[model samples]
Target: MRSRPELHGTNGAVSSTHWLASAAGAAAFDRGGNAFDAAATAAFVIQVVEPHLNGPAGDTPIMVYDAAAEEVKVVCGQGPMPSAATVGAFRERGLAEVPASGLLPACVPGAFGAWLRVVGRYGRLPIADVLAPAIRYAEDGYPLLPNASRMISALAPLFRDEWTESGATYLNGGRAPKPGARVRNPILARTFQRILDEAKARTSNREAQAEAAIDIFYEGFVAEAIDDFMATAKPLDSTGSRNAGLLTGADMAAWRPVVEDPVVVGYRGLLVHKPGPWSQGPVFLQQLALLEGFDLKEFGFGSADHLHTVVECAKLAFADREAWYGDPNHADVPIAALLDPEYSAARRALISGAPSSILRPGSPGGRVPWVPSFAPSSTATDGPDWLAELGEGIPAIMRLTASTGDTTCISATDREGNMVVATPSGGWLKSSPVVPGLGFPLGTRGQMALLAEGHNNVLAPGKRPRTTLSPTLVCTDDGRPYLAFGTPGGDQQDQWTLNFFLNHVDFGMSPQQAIEAATFHSEHVPTSFSPRQSFPLGVSVEDGIPETAIAELRRRGHQVRVTPAMSLGKVCATGARSDGGVFAAASPRGEQAYGVAR
Candidate 1:
């Protein structure tokens, strides 16, 4: 596939999953707003426009590069479990796992709070100024992109469940809006206006203004509305029965985002920085370690040797992830052991001369000496046949891949050389309405937890959910920030990110070439769904790859399946050149994705 030309450029660039969001950010940069300001604007617009993938209610994990300090810091924009939530509480209710809905899983929305924090610390413009574009878009409808329309149309059924406000807004007359249709969110617009007003009032104190705006939803008008709605509708608790101590005004008030260390790995000549353990960022490092001895370029990009080796490494890394990766505060994960080079090399040695190896149900390394079992037995026994069909059929071909919707990523760079890469997410569209005036939803990330006994990612109170969102950044050998990239696929995220990075770093491909190239996913590990052992170990490739390459891969023991040229990872990339010009690109596979620079 040919690389798409840069969309816009000045000294910096912005790339996001949606065109309007990117344009909004680009406009900020054009108006003399720094990257932080531009990114904040983009983030707000995405919440309003790309509600399915992300919203005000979601968690955002960010990696920011400060050119001035020559240092990188990670901000964990994830909400903690509600103070009222506890494992014993779940057990008493006969709920084997934290339900994806209801009060227990409703953490305070973190993205907005984080946005406020980032803007306060680094942004050049006031929050209100940064948020103007998003406000306008919400008040006045933006043109529907084909991708957003398709997403809405396809996921309409999922939104129909009465738990989310999304069904009310995106589904017109209880049906998904068609592509190219005019879509507006007046409620969100009003909400944005309020935030802008609050922001303007506290121009000198950005954090105070941000918090003031955030509080209205959790403690003010929005909270009362939510309490009232829950009182009348009396939605089922986490177990589909009444009496799950749903979120209260207090729970909303207590929410806050945390700043944490980036998961750093020394790979080749670059220092890779990704958000910490809650996400699968470390898995990329582990894969790099496993491939240390093998020359990836020797196998050639996209060849069977390259794909098979990388997939095997990925499987091993995920096995480690499933066994020991979790919120470090709650779980006794062997973080050091997992990242140990000696351990990684040993695991890599297990991949022998075979197209696919039988996957064993075990941890990557030995069992943690101090960790206790944390598993649940709840099963989704009451879903429609299609979900079951997907559960049954897809698993048979691939295991351990999370197929949930509701995630997106952004990679941005400023003229000053500062870069911000982030993955903001919530699980499948949640219906629990916050106060109507407040346009945020409580997180349903708990759905990502496993119900099986002895699983590493079993649900627990105050524990971060096992997330698929991994935003990453790479710095070149000469101290130049080279690339910022990430994607939005559950388990497929790491797989897609690895391929895209290799395309650019190892093969010298442009950002667009890396993104537009046909991609494949290998699922030989346990996924987030049940019947975890049924999937096949194979590669699903898009049409753009040459037939001969596919044939070669198949000949070398790959289970190859040809699929449409789909965007495997709503992947976006921003590359900074030594010459100081910034190049950005978004996956053409996504209808709403675009690159805008200025």
Candidate 2:
């Protein structure tokens, strides 16, 4: 549990899920690369070593702070659903949701697209140089770190279908590899080599190399292979098999990452930049607003009062998420209204005198600024008697399973004062093959929706799923960048980030203390899945909080349960002081996470 060596230079630092990736990126910064170069390098390396979480086949959402321009830019590396992918298409085929396999799961891979966009816009080094570390790791092999080995072993049993490529990768050799085992992804190596060669041939024009590499995946050999594989895949339900018909060669070839205006909200003196309603970023702001009126210090740290206030705020925010949040192109998300101080004040006024046995359903309040041209589908369903009974008895499923797992995050800063924070992932491995050589599975993120008619997140043509992934940046009142950080853990990410921010900003805790502090999550938060949804709302904090606090919560009518330590979240952070020195910290909860500053 000892901390790794702190990398410090007068210049910069990089922090991410794995130490190897962080070091590689820090080296890039030391080699005269900008923050974009460092971040792009780290991103490629993360795909190689942390394949279970992210890879070339995943999506990436990025925020770049350019010191020169003195402006922040956001890139939505999220791939879009194929134009042909419609709710009617799923129903006509008698499917409840988009099957994990074949075309339905396919989307334009956006990670590489985002990397290229950032480097082209902000980097000084060539793409080949930025990607060299990942190329070498993929070819030469790296040790299986503790966290990676644990995740692979834990998830191996779930890969029961022997025909899938993902099953072959994890379940092959008769058993999952243990930590410290040497693992090589030559296929991934070859892909990186190709990218490197293409970049070199482009005469160091990083953007050209990126475009060519993207072509190789979407319009070249990769596209042909995916299409061919889908043609012979198994049927999703009793009717017909899914295929790459929707994600034709043309879709991938035409796909490009988009740069959108970030939805910024001022908190105190700092500005929090979050992606649009396509993600749960606004939820964080809403939670922060709800807590503004409360004296958190009065609860004394991890007391019952602290946990109750946090959980109640989370529930209210989540309720609004269900009722109002969605892709702005398809639904009207009340962004401005949700962040209004007055609106938060009204919501805060609803807390009852006594701790309730169940969460109080919240209202969206006032009118949304932008309304959708067409009404979106709903996910509700008329269940059988047994299912109805289960829903009432166990609301935790709504709380726990609201989002799918599988994502990676990176935080980087360079000597010139540039910074970038990004999260790239979608859990397609649960549904598709680990394209041989790609080292990971394409995201079936579209499956986060329900097959039930009229669901808010139903798989509609050209619609994006509501993602739990959020990459964040904070700036000081004087407009200097202060922190860049993010995490991977689905719904737990927001809760963890909120905790860390409160620790650092409110309690004046250092990076290590903020990340290392014990934390609790609201079992009341809604999840993307069914069954346990909202059932655990009244559950109280067991561990983390002091024992006295637990007893007090019990006296206040909470149903508390004790459990072992969990991966509360895997968060990585890099902070800069007015003196220009950088401090980086990674969550000790993850065996792979580390920080490198130079």
Candidate 3:
């Protein structure tokens, strides 16, 4: 039996990475808002409650399935580098790779635009109404989470010495607030209120008002403050050197979020949808394609055989990610050929009973993949600079302590069948100096771009960084939406989501059961953050996995590390049921994620 009863409802349902955010979404449903409205409401609340993980200035890539249109679409909220951001500039700065923490890695913020896009086109409530929960929480205060408090305290020294604005904003009496202590962000509340005020002054039309709010973020005082701070400030970075940022007011005005068709692939009679090449989402499709060749049921769930097969496949898929994935607008992505049935069969042949430690990127469509040269950040004897090694950046340090990396997810399903999945991340508070008076930080998404010449993901002017923020939607053969799910683990996002999906579809687990299932992830490929490192044959499995399985993995050339049970994944999901009831589930790992339905 599933450990928890599935959350059932007909009116609506919302699952988010934070309990308060979930409650905010349920409040939207109570106000007669649709899934789109509820998701937007919860997204804003996440920024308020999980400030260390996400903020108003972060990037969010959303996947939405419109019941009316019977179609799934992606909102490309992943931001691009500024026109002045170039490889030459970094070279002049005497940097080998992008610094994990600094303004130099900042990109145009995209979450606000992505959220506005969804609510404007598919929502039933006013912009003001949808944002009310977040505003209230920010102004009135909410109890602090242990994770947030811990992250603040860990970076307290850096904030105090280098980014005073961040210290003043996150610290209470020059120290991190104790867990459960009430925390308020009056300035952040004012920042959000200013957008609503501008929108109300523009017009009474709901869509128009949403557009007005978007304009204020991109072209009004919000943009001005970001530009002023970036133009003058040179805050301490990963290299312990103060550096200026590249983003300008013109970049914000010039950029706009676009609606693109999701990349669709078939697996086990279900059609899966993921974001385009701009995100690491398509890797999930690649993994599924490889696994399709294997009879997973024969190996069985939680078995040593199953663990080895999946880890080996992940290494191959992620190896290709480091070589070929990038912004399709700038790079030639061979999606059609990469997902070809024949190509998948050829790749599947490489998987064996034992694990392979080396990076193995496949050539698709006769196009050679560009593998990065082995270049470590510092002249250290260690193999690669893992997240723990990069202790200077806030994101790396936070992930090292929390186990779950930076980011947050929100999923909602309304009575009308509309479903939305949004993953908001980037612009981590530790990555850049907080914009003065704005009460939020700017995104350092540009750090994901490679510095190698001629590589598809090379850092360049006006190019979107290949981000790790991925949201997924699954549908049946008849094109009916089945599930909307996602999580917040940087490189592990796709891996965790993939495991959760397989648990539900292949193993016949309920939504809650799938999220609670023993989880494992491979870190065999190069990481997405600064000081990028690769573990030739590394696998991290939860303690729940059988000891025999762990021992077998070790004997098979895999470096296995067991973590605490329920400490691996933070997935949140909402799906449509055959009985006309909606179901939602959230990970119980961090005690922050929750799902509510009624």
Q: Pick the lDDT winner.
A: 3
Compared with the true structure, model 3 gives a TM-score of: 0.97
TM-score of each model, paired residue for residue: 0.87, 0.86, 0.97
Residues 548-580, model 3: lDDT tens digits: 889988987889988888878689999888777
Task: Give Cα-based local distance difference scores for all models.
Answer: 0.67, 0.67, 0.86
Off by over 4 Å in 2: 1-9, 99-103, 146-161, 167-174, 235-246, 353-405, 427-429, 436-439, 450-456, 529-532, 536-542
lDDT of 2 by residue, 1-598 (tens): 2244434545777888888898898899767897789889999888888766667777778988889977777888877776777778776665555553334656667787778778877888877788789889987888876555654554454444332466566554756678788887777778778656755665555667666666666777666665555555542311123244366556667777778877776666787777777877778888888988888776668877887787778777766765566667776667788888898899898775345544443445644322112222222235322122112211222224332235678998876778899987753333345665455666655645444444455566667767777888888866688788888766667777888887776666777677777676666655543222444445534256688876776687666665434346667887676787777878766566778877
For 1-598, candidate 1 gives per-residue lDDT tens digits of: 5646755465778888888888888788777777777778888888777765577777788888878878787777776665556566666777765554545556556677787777777777767787788788877887765555655565456557643565676778878777677788888788778656755565557556666766665666656665565445544433444444445666667665666777777766887877767777788887777777688877787776777777778777776776667777777766777778888777877886465555532344576422333344343457643233222311221122222234677788976788888877762234243434555555666555554445456566566766767888888766568788877776778888888877776777777887877787777665543334424567777776678877877777778777666646678877676777787888866566788877
Model 1 TM: 0.87
Native-referenced Cα lDDT, model 1? 0.67
Q: State the local distance difference test value for candidate 2.
A: 0.67
Q: Per-candidate RMSD vs. true structure?
A: 4.2, 5.6, 2.4
How far in Å is the alpha carbon of 234 misplaced in model 3? 1.1
For residue 153, what is the lDDT in candidate 2? Answer: 55
**Could you tell me how far off, in angstroms, the CA of residue 281 lies in candidate 3 after the best superposition?**
0.3
Winner on TM-score between 1 and 2 is: 1
